[model samples]
Target: MLHSRFCCQWGNTLSSTLLRFPLADHKKVFAIALPMILSNIAAPMLGLVDTAIIGHLPDAIYLSAVAIGAMVVSFIFLLAVFLRMATTGYIAQSFGANDRAAQRQHFNHGLLLAVLLGSAIGLGSPWIIDFAMWIVQPDTQLIPLASDYIGIRLWSAPAALITLITLGVLLGRQQSGRAMWLAIITNGVNVVMDVILILGLGMNVKGAAWASFSADYVTAAVGLYWCARALNWSPTSIHIKFNALRQYASVNGNIFIRSLVLQLCMATMTGYAARYGSTVVAVNAVLMQFLMLISLGLDGIAYAVEALTGAAKGQRNPHKVAYWCRLTLLWSCIFAIAYTLLFWLFGPAIIGLITDIPEVITTAAQYLPWIVLLPLIGHWSYWFDGVFIGLSLSKGMRNTMILAAAFGFLPLWWLGLPLQNHGLWMALSGFLLMRGVFQALWLRLRWRQII
Candidate 1:
């Protein structure tokens, strides 16, 4: 109905931008998305490398500790992901409006927030790890090992958070090629470190933590250098505008709550997995790497949609927004289908690739069907997330996630308790589906301005 109305109201005339030159729009999508896909792909590859190296250890407990530790460290990043999302949305709008001053404001504010937050994380690393330990409550043996891994990894929080903002600015500006290279720099260094520190040095879990810690600084340095080169950026020039700070808090707060709820579900998953047993925890971890791999790869399209829709929203062009949405939706479905098929066909082999543990591979493959179904359930939400972010609409994003978690996931998780791990997967699947449904409905309700 939204598509129909947009066509009737502003048809053909909008073609000059997308309709007239469909291939150009296609080219634009891939230009932004391809690099993003490569960049996103490298991230999960790093995770796979981490899992693979840790899995080769003689005991499964090391794998469990690192997995749990990685989740905490990465969840911190996820919680702080508000920095990148808000910056990308705001900067994309500024880019669309050709408002250089606003662009600078968004970038500087994001940079400042990153530094402050990153520093806070660095100072609070011990407390954060301690809190995660309390909440997740892994087996007694895993507590110390997970703590060591989380502690070492959190040392680089400042750099990691800063890099997050940098990537957001790059993606928002549509300098996706540079963003891709930045990802390559961060993740490539991580992969090499995994090989050297984890594999060669045999530092076990500590090696993985150190690998992630070192990569953050490398990434932050390169990211800052690029910022300096492109924008003549410097900390000394940053002006602390009270109004801008207020705006950042207002917008970013909702985004933060939204991320918090999302991570809560993730944390719950890990927590529940721990209760299921150490084997289940490792299985969940192994499986999650693939889930993230699917989502991040699909996020290429979502990020493209965010940028384009943001630009469109800035320009007040309903037709452009609608056109880009349609294009993104097509690609989202295609990517989802491809991921489903790929996982369905290669799930066991891939699990085997991550861990040599016979039991982990076999038990993990039992739940491979859920992984096969996740891309289909989850991709649309990723698409709508782009739409909301592009339009600077965080409240909708927050509301949908809460409803999905509270109404869709929690109840389902409770009722299916008897099914054990499969029940957890069922609840998780419902969560993603509910999010997509809620987001789609919200988009429809907001169609006029969105289109």
Candidate 2:
């Protein structure tokens, strides 16, 4: 009886300790982050599979064409990702306010914008392809293959945009599992079709494009059905306001510019890497894949913070926002540390699996230390991005990105010219670090005002 009483007391003490330390907050954050993390990690595989299949072809030009084509499309698509970001912010706030009508209205506005814009992109495919090719200045041999890939992929623009909107809604509503399932189904189909069309039917890059188009539509269908059920909406009940449209344009426009600048920074980096020779380019590419993988995983947590913090702000609960932010930063730090360790210990083996080129492998392994450092140095900016987006403070986000690219990255790259590839990696790391620092300063100054 005495031992039982002592055990009960200890249990009470432990529970109280956990409550005070915000263990429950961690649980809430993870509940939303884990699925999104899985989805984000899987999303990249679609591109990787495309690259892998094309890389195995006898000619290197096929691989180059696919890479260039996909990069161009991805740049355009990523710029429009403001659709997802703005939608998430608006819907999450509405959800927090418990305003179902506003939620549905925002959904309608977002969907309409996506459809109109996507249709515009598809209709203007020829001009876009020409413009992209002119900017890239690809070899004569690659132009046709790249053109074919871009043309077919453009057909999926509408579906891709629709999927983006649905995902934003699902995430804003904290329906992470549903969102994840949609990604899995979509990417899964793309992978299967990649094999069939690329290998079995000998469609090559065209096959890959067709596979993405089909998978996108499939995902959009599933997303639309799921969104309808989740929102429990009738066609008649949905409303679109001109004022809401203007607001969306305002928010998304800023985000669009921000994303555009970001793409330019990345493109410039790649262009410079190319000047160092094909071996350096391949090595950098593999390193970038590592960085992207880490970022996607971290983005999962950032996304959760976006939803939770946006909701907290909508409800005018500063304490809740602070709580979520602290927990998210803590979790992000934990993840960064784990990633650092993983890359440090196993990066060479991972690089080998990515490619068999001995020169690329040797060069990449030499730079493995930088990859190990990336997660730690770069994660804070990602976390800040979530915080800014959640609070609908997009102007700061845009400004910081511009500043980071213009001042932080460019200057460092210029100064580090003597270091070659090492200099490039340094500049990239500096960009991320400066972005986090500047944004943090902005947040600090505006914290009370935002709340």
Candidate 3:
């Protein structure tokens, strides 16, 4: 009876605390987050749609080729993702400072940088593809198929990077709805083209690549239209300062390293899975979809945090930063718990929808528990990542990821090798958990400087 009374008291306290949360802030967060959630999900949907289409082909080689080809492109793109991250933080802070001129300048600079980098990647595709193929050493049968896919997709590099800058600008300005629309149109077009070219026209992997290529340019056009309207573009208004460019490059350089390491971790995961045989590789691929879903959903909230916290920093308001941090953390935890429950209850049904092979299903189930726990274990790192990006603390972010990869993930994998696939999942979980812990500790130690 005494324990029951204590529980009731605890529940009441929790309810009271929640009741005191600012409704306006909650609404603002969801306003930004909901659209972003949809937008982010559309990104992975492109890959999913591709996988679904290719997987239905007569040979599994098609699926493997598409998978490997997509991985190579994703890794390269992610390395340049600093275009989005840096642009968002810079623009957000500039917005908060009410510096319209600075904002316009940054916008122009971002686009210029995007164009230069994207063109470089496109022009140098041969070397990039060669490097990736050497690293992965795909099955002989898949080399030509994968190469064709990569060859066609590389042309979209410039458009893709430009869209990234445009979306970053809108998101940093808190115009998430517009940014969301851009993503929707792009992915939606890609889906339609994928169905038409691959399935309708029977163009195979090359068709899928062409669909993505076309959708990218279309998305770039839309993004350019919206961005021009927002900025009311004028040639006279554009100016570039050498100092500003240097500063931008410095921040992006750190982010570049951070992203490089993060992608390396993912590539390592996929590479290791491939060694376990075709069945295990297929199982890991399906399981990765679950992780991607969680990331896209959680990243919505993280994006909002990035905008709000960056603005707070520009305003020099520690209190506002702290408030946003608390609220976002609460929401993240709730989502993490919900994801855990959903996966635990419906893991089988979800797996069934992804693949029909009975053996794959059975093998996946043996490892389902790890995926179920992923959201809970890794949610904090996602949250911390937003905070660091918002504040432009890229060095700390880079350090923590390096530490997590080297100290946490590598050692754990070595120790758990006897467990095979289970060991990989365990190492991944440890890597994520350590990333959050180390980042949080770093933030705590440097809180004063950031605020």
Largest TM-score belongs to which candidate? 3
- Ranking the candidates on TM-score from highest down gives 3, 2, 1
Span of ten consecutive residues with least summed lDDT in model 3: 229-238
lDDT to native, each model? 0.85, 0.87, 0.87
Candidate 3: residue 120 Cα off by (Å): 0.6
**Clashing residue pairs in candidate 3 (N, C-alpha, C atoms within 3 angstroms):** none
Off by more than 4 A, model 3: 1-14, 43-67, 139-141, 194-205
TM-score-wise, the better of 2 and 3 is 3
What is the Å distance of residue 313 in model 3 from its true position? 1.0
Compared with the true structure, what per-residue lDDT tens digits does model 3 show for residues 1-451?
9999999998898677666678888888888899999878776667577678878988888788878888788777768888888888888888777777777888888888888988998899889889989988988899999999898888799999988888888888889999999888887888899889989999888988898899899998998888777777565666789799888878888988888888777777778888889999999999998987798779999998888888888788899889888988888997899899999999999999999999999999999999999999999999998888888888898899999999888998888788989988999999999999999999999999878
Backbone clashes for every candidate come to 1, 0, 0
The candidate with the higher TM-score, 1 or 3, is 3
The digit string of per-residue lDDT tens for model 1 on 1-451 reads: 9999889766554454354447878889889999988877776667677578789989999899988998788878878888889888988888888887777778788877888888888889889988999988899999999999988888788888788788877887788999899888877888889899977998888888898889999999998777666665677767779898888877888999998998888777767877889999999989988877786668889899989998887787888888888888888887898899989898888898889998888899889999999999988888889888888888899999999999878998998789989989999999999999998888788887544
Q: Please state the error at residue 255 of candidate 1 in Å.
A: 1.6
Determine the backbone clash count of candidate 1.
1
RMSD, one per candidate, in order: 6.2, 5.0, 2.8
